[model samples]
Target: MYRILIADDEPMIRKGLQKLVEQSGQSMTSIRTAENGFHALQQIQEERPDFVFTDIRMPKMDGLELCRQLAELDSDIQIVVISGYGDFEYAQKCLSYGVKEYLLKPVSKKAVHDVLDKLVRVSARQRTDTFVPVSRLEQWIAEMDDLVWSLREPELELLLEKLRKELHHYSLKLARFCDVLEELNLLLAKRLSTRDVFSLQTHLDLGGARDVEEAWSRFAEGIWSIVRDLKARRKGRAKDPVEEAKHYIEEHLAEEVSLEEVAEYIGLNASYFSQLFKQSTQETFVQYRTRRRMEKAKKLLQQPHYRITDISGEVGYADHPHFTKTFKKYTGFLPSEYRQNLGIE
Candidate 1:
């Protein structure tokens, strides 16, 4: 029992879209049409429809303005914009105002049906409160972190496959799906100690990704490329000094290790090592060391036998207040709070 409204100056275009929706066989309590954005706004105020489809160019107000108004009035209302090739820029602006879908002019029946199907699925999920939770997202990030750290190619592929299925099942909005990909990118970058040279924004061409399938294909390819590059580099002839540095850091987690100390251990000058480390890893030597220490602290916090002060010292933090502040910043939880969440006494 959902209400839908279509707004367009062109009578034929409005009628065609209405017919297309009706022909798609999706259940709707009512289907209304308006001649322009002003009329559409009036209709929306009188009866807030669950969905809106408006042409970019209308009489009183344009689709972009209409979208802005609707967003302010009701954040939950799903909006789809109808635009021509010339309105491409306007369409992108509409997205920022919470328009969920866009249809190019000469909209095909198949495209309309596809958009409707996605809206229906998303609406159903909203009703059921089935969106992916924050805890589940964190769990996924942790699993990805482990996979990247281990450098297990097969396992990583399997994980990506499962992730792809989850993305499809959720039928998330394009922006939300991209946000997840960005998080995965950052997690992999940090774990691999590599700079994010392959960000989705710069590396992947996802502008044409109208559906989950298209977007995921490009995203998966980008991830696979990163994996392949890392494997090839690992097997390359030159020994990786960054890997050696990481090993030294791990071994000296309980001690204060300086850049000069690690550089001397790896037989490189301190200044050269600092630059090389940043080039190989996205983070500087100090940032990497701090992250490793925080990760170790998280693990130790899970053990009830370890006192908070002892754990802090074990991870190179001599000051208890400093340790608590750093731990809270790193994990969004104080050490004690983290342990309590784990049910560890």
Candidate 2:
């Protein structure tokens, strides 16, 4: 449901817009009204509605000026100009500010309904189709709220892998997006989400981000709210013990380790941990660790500077025969076969 703000100097016009929004077929949760632009700006700053409808000619500030101030505050806020026919030029100017719709007064219920319909549909598409969630697109907000955050290369890599699982729901667009995300650094990666693009662009346009770290914190928080909610929905929990285990496995891929030892470290019994890990990650602990080792071995094999035995050992295998057997079991080929397939001499 979209939240709407109505700003008109005339009480009847404001009330009429609010009634149109409430009676419209589309869902609109909240309606706030202000008699003038200054009051409208105050209300907007406080509540931050999804859609704003303001008359172009008001006593205190007017719709165009209010729209300009809102653009300064957040480029994402949608503004709809309620204007007289003579105010076409003013409405045209507000277009550069990203106003959603403009309706001529005396406004009809149908006209307001049409504007609300467009706002709801466009907003919904932007929310679902975009990489970032609509509500919490600011990373700093999520960080301050004590949500999960990722910025460092290794942490971001882990996040990308998790996002892969998430992309199953949005697979069509996610393929290209995930590829782009794979190569982006912390700041660039945060900016990749289309929902943040406008706001970040505005931030860059104004001046240099003096408190980049603080801004990053806010942006990370926003990303986390989406991921955390999705994680909660699919997994039925806010925290995933399996994800924790996967992180440990990735960190320790080069060390000789076993599920039993990992279970001991985390204070869970081996059998239970194995079940939960498989449930969360869709791979058993043994399979996950073995795959990590194979991935590392593949990277090392590409070097050609390292012997197979040394590479296998470097990835936690002590016995050459056992390592080859497990690698073949997982990859459907021996280590040499994998290297040869890559055309590596």
Candidate 3:
């Protein structure tokens, strides 16, 4: 039920009608009163109600004058002229001033209830026609932002379809479309403002859109671009622990670095890094380090000036004996034999 304002000179009439309207429909329906037509107009100007019921014979300004002024003020406000059977002609005159219903002086509960039902139907039609609240519009824009952030394409499609249908419910004006576009743009912009790269305003402008479909096209494209850029940025910047560990190992091959040290250097837990290293390189850390040491020893052995004993210490070995033993195992010959074989070659 709609909000109602009851206008009458008689105190009992205003109170009785207010009580009837309150009981006739819903407790939610707000009912206000005025002593005369002049006071009723003043209250309406302050705050417009959905419906007005005024007595035909009132002091200061009569109900006929109120109806006339209300027609000029807002034709949409549903008006019901109230008067006795003796003033039926006076009440009928209110019809030309946009008054539709009439309430007889001896008011009945049934009469008020019937009038409320009629007013409710008219109110329902007006609500659906072109009366979406600003708060509700903001809520819709907020939901759109949520979908965009999560990159929910399927759900976004459905939301866009819902918004498209709303286009018919409202006036098809470019200004209103621009308002929605701007609100959505600002919301996303604020959400991503802390990020280093990408700006929604630079990516798309819905101001040039001729209609709702075009505006949606531009908006969706901009959002998809942001999603793509976000995905690309994440993929490109992702750290590779194994590759970093391998590079560190290759650089410090001669140095005796433990598996735990390498894991610490790469910011990984020791036990987890051990498994990852084996999976990535197919060799334990010690095995890989020993293999690299042996390979480095062979390179030093080829250069005769760098003695085998010096190469032993250079390759992280404590003694020449250990290095020779490990070298023979790796190359199928002792370090001296490998040197001799290279000389013969």
Candidate 4:
């Protein structure tokens, strides 16, 4: 017994659709009607209907805008857009917002019944198929963040494919999909800062995309562009082994990075690279790594949500006691005392 809303500009059409839906003998609990998209949005907010039948052209807001707003508010609600033949392409674009069906002008009783029947079947399937747990979603987002920061072309393409599959499989609305993109953007900004990668803020405008596919395409392109720019920057700069080692250290702060590994990566002897690192940074490799770990640990401590153990692991200390000792040595206070002193708890 799903609640339904029919929004159209004309009174006769609204009445006709309402009557048609009632007479269709569908499993509907309530039937509501509105004269335009704005009024329909109001009804939706108040009633939280399960399905919406809206016209393409309406006052204050069009069907597409209504669909977009509705998706942001509630992704679970199903939308069926009604449009004339002239607005067919526009109606097609509304599908990106997770519209279930598109009905052309002068919709017949049979068409309404067929759409309702299809909705019932689709809803039934979705009940089982599209129920992604919060933990799984978080895992996917974390994996995506890792792949983006890896800056490998093959992995990037795999991520794009995964995104496309998730978009279809989860039936993600524009809002949720945009949220995924936003998380990726944040990860890019955080990880690429070591190499001075360009800002992706302008390119992450998912709201301005014409459709979901366009948004995804733009996002993929932006990732590729970033990868290319990073490569170009690396190539254009004269090889500075010490600077390269520093960038590598910054990027791999969580890893158990060693001077030998970095020296090998930069095609330099370990002893020579060690001297160069100490000379350039005014600190030995071990001291620099410790300082970076302590600095990151302090920043993580400032956030109350981060547990001391979690912060310890994040900064590459597997043993909690060791991390506490190191933190105290660097900041003159244990992580807990530091947080308490700052009144973070």
Q: Lowest-scoring 10 consecutive residues by lDDT in candidate 2?
A: 201-210
Model 2, 78-164: lDDT tens digits are 788888888888688998787868899888989888888888777767666655442322342333223332223355445544544
Question: What TM value does model 3 have?
Answer: 0.43
Model 3, total clashes: 0
Deviation of model 4 at 33, angstroms: 0.7
Candidate 3, residues 13-52, lDDT tens digits: the string is 8899988987874544468999998999888865567789
lDDT of 2: 0.65
TM-score for each candidate, following the candidate numbering: 0.38, 0.43, 0.43, 0.38
Off by over 4 Å in 1: 130-345
lDDT of 1 by residue, 258-317 (tens): 998987666555776788799889899999999999999998888889999999999999
Q: What is the lDDT of residue 251 in candidate 1?
A: 97
Where is model 4 poorest over a 10-residue stretch in terms of lDDT? 194-203
RMSD of 1: 19.0
State in Å the error of residue 79, model 3: 0.5
After TM-score superposition, what is the CA distance of residue 192 in candidate 2 from its true location, in Å? 30
Per-prediction count of colliding residue pairs? Answer: 0, 13, 0, 0
lDDT for model 1, please.
0.78
Would you give me the overall lDDT of model 4? 0.76
